[model samples]
Target chain A: MGLKKISDNTYEIFEEGMNVPARIFASKKILESVEKDRTIEQIKNVAKLPGILKYALALPDAHQGYGFPIGGVAAFDMDKGIISPGGVGYDINCSVRLLKTNLKKEDILKKQKEVVEELYRKIPSGVGRGSRLQITRKELNNILEGGAKYIVEKMKMGKTEDYLHMEEEGCMEDADSKKVSERAMNRGIGQLGTIGAGNHFLEVQYVDEIFDEKVAKSFGIKKGQVTIMIHCGSRGLGHQVASDYIQMMEKEYGFQNLPDRELINAPIKSRLGKDYYSAMCAAANFAFANKQIITHWVREELVRIFPKVKIDVVYDVCHNIAKFEEQIIDGKKRKICIHRKGATRAFGPGRKEIPEAYRKIGQPVIIPGSMGTASYLLVGTKKSEEISFGSTVHGAGRVASRSEALREIKGEDIKKEMNEEGIEVKAGSWKSLAEEAPEAYKDIDEVARVVDELGISKKVARLKPLVVIKG
Target chain B: MKFKFLEHTADVKFQAFGKNEEEVFENSADALKEAICDKKKIKAAEKKDITVEGGDYESLLYKFLEEIIYLLEAEDFLISKVKEIKIKNFRLKAVLSGDKASDYNFNNEVKAVTYNEMFVKKIKNEWVAQVVLDV
Candidate 1:
């Protein structure tokens, strides 16, 4: 457990077994809290994995997860390394989407409760909740392969411009539905527009503060302008994909040699690895389609309420995923498999992956806060690419368990508190609300400050929740 | 007590107790049931049979619990009771009973079952199993 303070808000641990050093990007205060869990040990173990390049890194919001720490980020040699479902997490492509609106804060304030209620009623959420729009088995396959493009072009759900602002343009070309399991397809068929529970939410927020006027303007943001934030994933489809692949990998390659059973992986060149990657891409596509349909629903509901409101996609980012991308490593450009679990890809300016309009400013990194906290809009910086492989924290990582949160706070009380703060909140159940209380997570302001100070992702604006609809 | 929740930093963890493997597996289902909704309110209106195999007790338990999750999500079935379970060698067979999920209100969602910190074994005379679920 020997960790050296390598630089300001950066720590490194290189040990005997680890093939590469484990680096953690955290302020001193954040590092203290991070060490309280198994995050350090998990990242250290990740460093020892086969073919790991650069270093196993943890963002500021690092917390203990099943295999990889929630905020863990690592890149591996494409041919020499491995692909693990655990590294990508259970909810594949569990991501965030931001929508900019022409309406102002005052426009929503007058009808905040009605707005939240309409959204909660329109969007399908909670456990076992199916979408209002159902698709055939064949249609589900199309979505799995097409992602947001299918929803827009074939289904006529959203605009083509909508997917343009998303990562991978809302589709990962590697997706192949033939590689996905029937069980996963069955689970996804009915969940296209639904937002499954456990930290997933649709929040109506407004820009409260802007740190950089130029970047904020470029991203179509202004103080007091309203916005919609959708946080969800592939739902049961992604969950099934992860479980199916994990079990498949376990059967193919015994976990006796792995550091952790959940850390089970397959060589990148293996058939199982390629199959899992394709299946994972298919699931990620499903998630993209899920959010796209939800966006359409939100637009329909909002227009019914206020005909003048104009909402457009700001940016969308996948927090949990693995991708093969070319990056400069140790003075050499190489294609590596990068797994980002509870981390955001904050590619700096001029990276081809970023959307064309915002290429000069860099990728828009949307880091959402816990329920009833301030979310931040950030821009990726060159420093992040040089030090942490172009990644940043995803959110205010959980500080307490669900049982602890439930025992300590009542959901009704949280609702009352939020109401008193002038934020309208609606949920399917009170228990889930209590489990996701802002108290259960780290201070998002501090988490944002640490990354901004580290020069990984510079803060562009801060958004305050006005209406929250939790799944 | 059949099962009780344990502390974990980010997800749901529970430990189930029984006199043998079969009982422990049943209690584990009960734990999962409670995680989703109040089992007491669920009516055994329907029944489904589940058969799964694994290489060991741990994998067997994982498969069993994962099957229940699949039933809940894919089939929209809310399991109230583990009507019966039989473990032979590395395979498991069980009968579960519950009502449609749409007919009930779920308190939480069990996203997936993880092998992380999962165990099933005998301690002295009491059979025990520990599971951490992704929520």
Candidate 2:
């Protein structure tokens, strides 16, 4: 509760239990909503964790999650720190991908209904919806290790350009399929191209506005150009991996000294910790492979509508993940484990971690808002690395609970409203739509504005949804 | 009659009650079933037995709820109800019945059970368990 306004857009809390101060980056308006929940407390608890380097941070869209607040970021010293499943979150590599198409808004408007319907039919979505592309358990292991690269090169689902545009080249090289448990493998074998329910979606959108023309051109975007965005994770595979490791960690290292049971972790150098990292990477690779397969389907479905349509990968970003990266810690560059939950890596220009094509312009950070809202495309700034360890908010954070949204909104009514607004909407169930109504989330434009104001990630373009496919 | 959902920002929260530990565990399974689908619509066409061990009562409840998720994810079994349950020395055994998940509509995807604000306790006359599910 001992929060101090450190600067124009940052707050720091240093209490008795904290080893380092917990910092929150937000405008005054966003801070008010953040204070309404336990996000502040969660971050403070994160600050108490062992070997935490710098301070625990919450972004503008920070919201209370189970152990660590959603939109949380923290770095830990590899030697003395711990790797927590709660920090990386359950949906390992829950990410977003953008595809820039040559088609214009008018081109999509001509056959919006048919396109939406075709996409809905082609892509398996919703709870318990199995993928159409089935693979053997051995093939699933290859995907777990090979990631998007395997899908692009081996499966021939996409081109070299596809994986090149993704973070980590669409695969974490350290991913070891053997580290993944049998139960996790069973859950994932049939879920490669499926989008599970609960806030996962694929939206057909068009560029509404461009603020940085040069950067927008580099990212292959223009005013009125159509772009498709896919939002999903590794599906059941990722979920099971997190559960498997969380239980394993709890059994290996009891939570007696931890602040919360969900915050249970093992030393980074421990065998158990290394195994989790490898398993986590494997799960993340599955997500990349999953999205790649879906990309192929999306292309197949859209090409039928426009034979000449050209779709290229703009970028793909994983918000829920942990990785080892070199950062300047106390005037010396050292590799530390950075955990980003409900946050995106916004690496600035010249960072070797970025794709070669965009390395000079910084990583393309894609922030997809709730359905029917305006999403933003931003480029990372140098200030982001200095302030928030090259990270930024993921989306318009949820402000209301699912039950409250269900109680107040009707799915049929929401569909009608979206239709009137010229957005084609398709979903597996009416209840799923109601639970994710735009009103249940904070205003995305405002959330983006706060980050832009802080210079963490500068906004380049805004996208308006033309069609929404929800699971 | 046994469980009711509570409010949480980004997940599902619920509390189940019973007269004893076994009854509470059964109702908790019912609570999980209700979260996935309409339990009445699910017929108990198949039955499977589950066994799990934990360090304490709280973890025992956690593992029990997680088995429901594992069944739904790995085995494609949507547990309709818990026909029998028993807990001894931090270990649990139960008989569960349900059909394939593809047979019915799922309202939401319950990703994984969490220990965040989880509890299992007995108060004066009633046994209670609290859980928060990540969806």
Candidate 3:
């Protein structure tokens, strides 16, 4: 497949065979940086899938992935399109959320080590780590069916207002527990409220700069103020679901017949597709609940340390997984399965999906940079609908794998560098620190610049890490 | 034939070069077992038959490994040694034996197997399969 440079920061994957002439928005420099990656091939492969509506899109942070590229966005006609677990990724609903606090940077710096240590102890980390609370089979079923709503309604962890600020209210009504296998349930039973390893973390940051004062104020972010961001997902249960469905789809859909088995998929109308969707949604809900429980835990830890510190959730968004949403294409409202793998939804202002309070300011897009770099807070724009399906880059896309990262950067040295840079770092294992070294990812500012220049999303505020806790 | 583990952003990859596909599959499973549990502690005292059905050879290989992972976690059975292995178009049947949970020395705990970087290909009349297991 030949790609043509349409603009300084954009490339067009011309329509060939089954594709609809896809377009990728990125800077010339960013495109050159990712040209050698297999993600380009994966994006073209996605264009060949059956019933792909509009264009098979990719964000600036795109990288090679299972079936689709990470940071990929594609919408398929719900009636004729196929759903592949590979598109949603193994870590279902792997997402990020920002919590605004009344405390300032000086306040956190006074007790940075203590607060991070307390958070590390309160939040379970590492692989196969389970939370302090173990759920019975019955409760697990409720979690699968009800999602975060169940926790707020039954467990009283948070209120309905909390869900209102979340994407989809932290639950998809289509979640069906019966479709989930027992083995998957077993994996999720004790994993809630736990932060798994590998690129997942909870960082305490300070507002370094405000790009859009209106949007930043709307998100309750003020310069020099403190905030905490949680990055995690459904844990083992989501992985099992992806595995279970990938095999099932391979058999039911005859993967060999497809151009790429990695893109193995079943029509959304098929039983296998429906079951996977239901199970995937359930896993996504599990992630929402997991984060909710973690929020409560963080609040508890804050109360223990600084009783005066008050923290409120700004917004939560899922970067992975697919959702059924209505988008106008060719002046017709059509239902499409929007697959956002390693991407985030950036609904512009006045969009009904935005929370009532945020309806005037657009959806808050939280883009977390690497461990040491600056993170950003952006908002959706109307132009995003024309380019991406109201989607944007999730984070600083990886430039190196864990092995490569470890080879080039040492964990202890990275920790030392972060400390010297005025950022406190703590992790269950040093290996994790090296694996997530800042050098492993692209400069997030360039990624944000591409989207901003393309009018996809507007910058709201920039955040600098004060303390990072990794599992 | 030598087998080594290759790490990815999301999964643990294994590259095994062998004289034949069967040998590679067997070694791939062995490499995965070594990664999960200590081979020395897994005694061949118990015998179990494993069969995985799939739509193609690659998917079959994935399911086959997934079955082994399940047995290791659910029954604490490790594949210390491979007694027999059989592969068809869409099915992998194996006869394996191992002991219960004991002192195990393992490098990385594979949480699950993903469809990422998963393929079975035939090159120069020899079969080679590459799989990335989620760690």
Candidate 4:
């Protein structure tokens, strides 16, 4: 457990016998915060996994985690490496999206309460609340495989550009419905478009400041402009997929043989690995489609309130996933499975993955802070490829657990405090509100500063939340 | 004596406390087993020897749990309990016993193990491990 400080903002946990060295990017303060938890050890465990290429890297928001630390990024050689369900997370494709509207702060303030209430009424929130799209198993399968593109093609809610703005263009080509278990399909059959509980939210925000005017303008973001942010992902279906795979891997993969059981992985070429990958991709697609449908609903609600208001998508990015992409490692292009858990893909400008419209400004990285704090809009830098494999922090990583937050502050009181600060908060349950209190998470500003200092990503704009709908 | 499923977004989470690391590991396994099926029906069959190696205690635990998960998936064996757990700085070897269920029966399927909200710490003199399995 000896860690060598590589730089002022970086540390390296060298690989021992049968281990790879783990590199962690963070400030001294962030490192100290992680040291208090079990994340450092977990990072070391990730290094021991089979076929782990390069280094197992942890971001600034690192904290204790199961197989990999939250905010962990690792790349594995596609030819020799394995894919683990633990790496992708249970909520497969849990992501965030930003939609810009024509309305300004003044216009939103005129009907803020009404707009917020309208959103709550239109979109279902809380645990187990299903949306209006109640499809059978057959339809659900299509949703799983189709993703946002399917929704766009079938539902005709948005254009092809909507999909283009998304990571992987909203649909992963390898998604195979047959790879998903019947039980997993059943769990997801009725849950599409629903906003589940615990940290999932839909917020109305205002662009208060623009740091990178060129990038902000490219994204159609302007000062005092109103925007909506959707934060959600594959629900029960993705969970069931993870659960089924974990159990299957546990029983099938011998513990004594592998470097780490929590990193229980199937060879990329193995049947189990292929099935899990296909199903995981399906779940990821389901998440994209779910968010797309929700976006349609959000648009409908806005139009109902502000008849002339126009809400257009800014960008959508997946935060939890294992994607295969070619990156120049050691000056040679190599395909690797980049597992970004509690992290985001920060591809530099002009990368093929970025939309053509944004080829000049780079991919927009949205880092949402706590409900009461200021969120940031950042653009990827070429420097990120060297430091983090083109990855960045996802959010204000949680510093306090739900129980701890509930014990420290009352939900009602927190709500009152937000109200006084000119923010509106709405949730189906108080416990949900308490679990997501601002104090429960790390200071996002500090996390952003570290990423900026490291040149992984550059801040583009700052956003202030006006209304929040939590489930 | 047993773990209860706490509501998580897409995973089955359990919080348990034990007097020692061995008990904590045993209890965490028990929690995971319970999460998969009815504990009363999951009887111990032939004993199985399992070993996991990691760079640290936490990784060792993760490897240990993954081993159990692999066994269940590959062999359809449902582990009932951990009989012994011996841990060093970065290596863990343990003995576990469980039966292969004729049919899979559980409330939820855990897809993978996540590093989200994962913990193994000491509270006073007792050891506590909390994990959020990706379901």
* A289-349 per-residue lDDT for model 4 (tens digits): 9889889999888888889988787889898898888898768888888899889999997
lDDT of each: 0.92, 0.92, 0.81, 0.79
Report the lDDT tens digits of candidate 2 across residue range A1-471: 678999989999898878889999989988988998889989998999999998999999999998899999999999999899999999999999999999999999999999999999999999777889878888888999999999999999989999999999999999999999898888888888998899999999999999999999989899999999999999888988998899999988898887878898888989999999999999999999999999999999889889998889999999899999998777788999999999999999999999999999999999999988899999998989888988999999998899999999999999999999999999988999999999988899999999999999999999999999999
lDDT of 2: 0.92
Quality class of the docking in candidate 4, CAPRI style? incorrect
Model 3: per-residue Cα lDDT at residue A62: 84
Q: For model 3, how big is the iRMS in angstroms? A: 3.5
Which ranges in model 1 have alpha carbons more than 4 Å from their true place?
Answer: none
Candidate 3 at A45: error in angstroms? 0.7
Q: Worst 10-residue stretch by lDDT in candidate 4 chain A?
A: A254-263
- How do all models score by TM-score? 0.99, 0.99, 0.92, 0.81
Q: After superposition, how far is residue A176 of candidate 3 from its true place, in Å?
A: 0.9
RMSD, every candidate, angstroms: 0.9, 0.9, 3.0, 8.3
**Winner on lDDT (3 vs 4):** 3
Error of 1 at A37 (Å): 1.6
Q: What are the runs in model 2 whose C-alpha is more than 4 Å off?
A: B38-40
Shift of residue A225 alpha carbon in model 1, Å: 0.3
Candidate 3 residue-wise lDDT, A1-471, digit = tens: 578888767787865565576667778777765676677777888888888887888889987777788899989988878888889888899999889989999998999899878888889876434579878889988988888788889998877777788888888899999988887877677678988777888999999999888778878888999989999988878878888888777766666566567687889988898899999999999999999899889988998889987878899999998988888776787888989999999888788888898998789898999888888899998788766888999998887776778688889999899999989988866777887898888899999888888878899888999889887
Encode model 1's per-residue lDDT on A103-173: one tens digit a residue. 99999999987899899889998876688986788999899999999999999998989999999999999
Query: Best to worst by DockQ, what's the order?
Result: 1, 2, 3, 4
A432 Cα displacement, candidate 4 (Å): 1.3
